[model samples]
Target: MVIRGAGRLTAAAVGVAVTVATAVGLVLTPSSAKVEPAMVADPGPPEVTISIALGGATHGYVNPDVALAQGGTLTIANGDGVLHTVTSDALGTSGDPLFGFSVPARTTRSFALPSLAGGAYGFYCVFHPGMRGTLTVIGGPVGEVPAPPSFDQALRIPKVLSGDHITIPMKKADVRIMADGPKTTMWTYGGSYPGPTIERRAGQQTKVTFVHKLPKDAGSMTVHHHGGHQSSADDGQPTKHLIEKGAKRTYTYALRDAGKPAPAAFNFYHDHRMHVTARNNWRGLQGMFLITDPKEKKLGLPTGKYDVPLHFSDRSFTASNQLSDPFGHAAHSGHGGMPGWMTGEHAPPNDATVGQRILVNGQYAPYLTVKPGLYRLRLLNASLFSAYDFALSDGSAFTQVGTGSGLLPAPVTRQDVLLGPAQRADVVVDFRGKAGQDVLLSTIPRSDSTGTGSRNAALMQFRVRGTTSQKARVPGKLRPLAPLKGVPGKVSKTWTFDLSEMHSGGQHGSFWSINGKMFKASRMDHKVRMNSVEKWKLRNTSDMTHYVHLHQEQWHTLSRDGDEPPPWEQGLEDTWRLDPGEEVVVAARFTDFPGVFMLHCHMLDHEDHGMMAQFEIVR
Candidate 1:
């Protein structure tokens, strides 16, 4: 069966209970009943400015954490183009301290911290889940220290869910995840970090009843069947059918094939809770969805244990071995709808939280024992940010087979395979006759496939074992893809990705926008004719990378920067990460079913920050 990646969630700081009103109620009167000037008090001690630096996917702010004195005024500058809030449950006595304090994009907000006992305090942006920091209130002189990741041994692979139809319960549980040298507490589904994999067959109907049993503080959830082309009601779009704590909803997928010639492929399912997606996913509310067909299987591709589904992601840990960053939960007044600007209506373009440790199936530097033969490796870039250019340390070439959506026209042999957030690639690793060999799977940093040079960082390892007579081979003629040279589609529309507002103080932080407008769920940015093929051009105007993803249907990448895409991208794809100032054209036919689908940056944080837009497919 084909495979895709899922998301995860974690826990944050806990302190006293309090509530604060974020909105100010305005009183109406006849000409505003002699509004008096608000009393201007004497300005207190000057604040120490802490700028929230935004850059790179997977790494939002350069200084996400900070240290300060116990009793001092603070100024936090939102250096990106998005709204943010610095709230700590450790602060305030009567209410949620974050309620009235919000820092607009490219602006700064100052606040006075009540004199407190010297200790550590955690803070985060209410709008962006992964945007978190630590405040070490030094009493005397010693400063605060940042927590490091917990890494350890390679454990058993993440559990895979079988059976054609099944019941998936989204529950609150805990699992010990080892990364670099230690095991950390990770919130999970079915007591596993990645939950379980769900498998199905093409042209077969499947029923999945998602039961939610998470605690109230864990927040509400809706399961999005990512990469599934189903009706709107079954799409699991946020706010459509949310299962609050203790509530359950069953989503049924007809699971028919798109009939696009490409072999059956894999996708993923995860929590799409309107606002807290980053946190919920960071807590591990995601799993894989697999679809099988006779065509690909008959080709004698690696099946069963030999065909592996690998999920690549990164996460950070607190000093106590608890999940930090995206794992921490923020206490927002409520979920859904547009938030106030000060609270950040959207996420900044550079707000993709990259973790410190790269994990494969929840294991740090995991080593997979593979038979000395051919193995079909399904690679899914499940990271919230971070695009990877995969290559073998031993200089072994990877035979490109297929992708998250389906198989390519033919296999392409190359050393490096670039995968962005939410993207997938299926490759055949020929380990034939090589026993007791340790091959390192590394990532080429900033390997955008531009004319620039590339750097390498080791990710995971492959330990080759005994040989097998059951030879798994890559078919000479895999599948046929449509010729992009004469693809039948007009350049009907164009979408440009860039900053909407340059924030208040001209800080580097800016809100991600399409066509110069922030995302609004109620707004329909585009309209498509049902079952009609159309080509859309995407232009990235920002200096950061943006992975564009379209829902409901997989698209055929026609060209990149007026040139043919890499051979690996010749087939259908649901997401493509574009570098700064890059332009690409893709074609898609919205068939089967379509209502209101989203087209957005796959950097989940960016999507949460208003970089997403909706389009309707009309009959």
Candidate 2:
């Protein structure tokens, strides 16, 4: 006879009487005789089915705790559209799982539980540690269950690739973006979502080979060294040279600006395929590039593991954990469709794509454990369109030491740092006083004129623990940056950015334009004499925001709407944000290898549509 109880029976109490009666076969005599007639029509062990829940980590299992017979059949139905596993907790002296069953996405699997002394059994998803549950058996000895893991997982830092010659292959990989989410299939570089960090010295020359291994449907590709000053042949012109499937290309970087060592800065590399830049970049072809100099090491700053690079981006996933294509639907469709004026035979490019999920270094809201000390954070806004106003939840201020191009002459204390798409910032954050506290790095939402801003606010968490004896300080003076050698108010060129309608292929459609002209691949919009310093005025007439990024040389902002530039804008910058009806004057010197380079909106969706133009520096 089976007996069930909330508490286990004492061995001492049951051993003397129960053991003697069971050994003599007297315990089951009356019960077995009464059930003998019913045993002939036994219907086998009981069966129960459990479902893996949908949504996020909060909803783990449909029936988390279940009680069943000792040897019942257990079935797991996985309808979450991603692979999952039912793994028992560690048991026995060796600490191995008692039983495990693999269940694919949208499928079911069944297994019979081993007959053992009854107790509570703990189980969890192998892929997602946050998913856990308990199973209770009716009659048996009690088992010890370990506590489940927390929702926060350690942040994953990308491996660094440093060498004279580097070869990176592009392919598809399944990556886990959240601690409690399914694996997502993404096009990756070196089989990683954000690829690998490429580190190089300021004055070193490096040769990089990009091998295309993506599916044929992915089509041609191009890699743009966003802030590198290289020759035209290696500049990754969107329409000129292309890397097809099963093909490879080599790009050589001299790492010099007009025979001078390039400034040490944190930059990025990404896809630049014409008409599909947004699509390819959204799929995961992006990475961080760091340029170092020996002289900068003299400054007292954090190094090695203490210095962290945080890349911020956004993504949306389907129920099956696949990336949602922002441009896959018909332009006129009411749901997630393009603007009404964007109808055409070809797929219409999106105005902007803001995802609900915010990812830091390819993971969702990961936490970084740090010792109590000062840390240097290199922040990059790699998203396709979303801009972030970064701040710490504790309301602590950080020291801003650098901008996109390089270090600033003097450090400035800032309550928050604002970065547009393709922009970067170097800051030093002090966590010595915040030990045993958890601080969140989050974004303060700004008003979006296009109504496509990201809803996600939290970026990551910093769990402060441990002690540190290391002493490092942010120097008041870090580097020297000279002003651009150009007249203050002299405007060499005036470019107007606006949204306008154009007639093409016997149809009228809206397009983002610069200076009232759409992009033409074979056309050169402007020409400048090499080694000439010039000032340009950029005016945004449209209601939406635009991020202007220039290639080849970094520029200094002279004024914003006829007012002095902010402290963050006083340093050398490669990108600037222009609000509605705002005009910014910037000064730049066109030098180095003279060739055709691009100047366009860093909002990739706008650039892919028509907001790009080319300029040539003639010797």
Candidate 3:
């Protein structure tokens, strides 16, 4: 009998037959004609094999239900980059597992089910309770197996805190990403997943005191005011001014651009520890920071309740609803391939960590009720590695009025906005005539061929209801942006992003790097003259996409691969996406305070690895 394993089995068993025939000749003797009957051994029960794997984010298990003969084999394959298990639910208690065998990532295992009785049994993964399946035992050959809900929760806007002197406590709290999901423990700012929105007027001096209340093992914390023009002491360098556990540290922001009121902008604050930046941010120590210039009130954009800040991020949880370790064996390498280093050992610092679930404002596919009018949406991509191509479900256009640092000179109409990690876009979405309709804010699938991109498409929903008498329109001219002056054909410096092989602590692997060198705290890669405008060329030589981010100052994109930048990139920007082998030229005038600042990939995993460098501004 031949045993075969396939993704699906249409029939239960394969049959084997043996035929015996005796030929008699007329001239043959009786003794010679009588041939001994060939003895045949009986073939017992035929064995059937069923093959299944871990489906992508959307589908929990490829074949959730399957039938197998009483005496057959079950082959389990884990195609994902993460570790998963196939355990009988009937053998173990809720939290204490007593039965299932472990299956490492990117491996296959076979189990014999001959000893089990002819009945139905349930199974699940020990790491992920959400992953469950059913297996049935039949007396005969197994036949074909059979196959396999939406967002209705209200959006939870982060609590707003506005004052010159604000205090936020960093502590662990129990929060729920999905309305019906289990409670997840997260390291939050002021006990919230997104912390609190810190709103301040431009030109005002604000000081925020962060009290470190997380467990001692949480390590020292540093708060980075992303996109802020602050001094080196407050820039949140990995080793500068850390807030130790049970201690407090204050960060001061001038909120000014060279002694003048800074243009109204959207920024954010998050943890930026040295090697744990990715893990810290993934645990939820981030929030939105808004700088408002009273002068912009004349533009008449959406304000008050009509203005909304949507923070997008992706995460994965364990069976107990705790954040999964991005570098752990059970965690999925967001890059879609296995880590270059060993599993169950020290993590490969360069691997990208992508999550299975996408969230908006800390809620899983939540909904926001809106009035029939124009509203301003402040969009921020806070995820560790994923980049979202945001679009409306109805195929409506968004009037983009602002880039990363501040408002654009004019509103550019865009059908969809692509935001890399740590990038922000301010757009005006009009729902004027679409009352009583549910419009979903969804993301386009990633075009890159690296990893299995996010399966969750819908980020949130906009439930347009009620009527408003006010008519708001995006102005043709929103602000004045003076282009950075730079001499043509003169390049100040060029930075290349690539991957380099390194041997550290007896482990050898390829790590992300800038200019073929890993990050060194004592090394400075570039020095720029203060208040001098210079053009710089950025290049990506690696095989994967990268989101390049510069601290302290926002720059203007001069050209992308020798072509003018897109409408959304025409404004002052701090982060730029670089596909494999793509190059970009940008110009910026170094001003204000800049002692030692960082320039690196915004993908937190890449940043945490060695794909970062430091620069200094000299007078």
Indicate the residue-level lDDT of 363 in model 3. 78
Name the top TM-score candidate: 3
Task: Please provide, for model 2 over 1-619, each residue's C-alpha lDDT reduced to its tens digit, 9 standing for 90 to 100.
Answer: 0000001111112111110001000111111111101112233347877788553123567877776666787888877634455555433211123444545445576766655345566565532445667766665443322221122678989989989999999899998886655788899888987989899998899898999999999999889998888888788889878899999999998888868889998988899987788789889999988888888879988888789999998776554556766555323542123344254322122245544356889986689999899999999999887777787878899799998689988899998887878999999999998889987787653433321122225567899999998778888788888766655457988888877765555656667899988789889888989989888899998645688998888688889999998888888888988876889998888877788999999988788878999989899
lDDT by residue for model 1 (185-272), tens: 5556666767787777777777787777777787677888888878777887776667777877777777764554324787888777
TM-score, every prediction: 0.72, 0.73, 0.75
TM-score of 2: 0.73
Assess each prediction's global lDDT (C-alpha) against the native.
Answer: 0.63, 0.70, 0.70
Model 1 per-residue lDDT at 464: 86
- Ranked by lDDT from best down, the candidates are 2, 3, 1
Q: Pairing residues by index, what is the TM-score of model 1?
A: 0.72
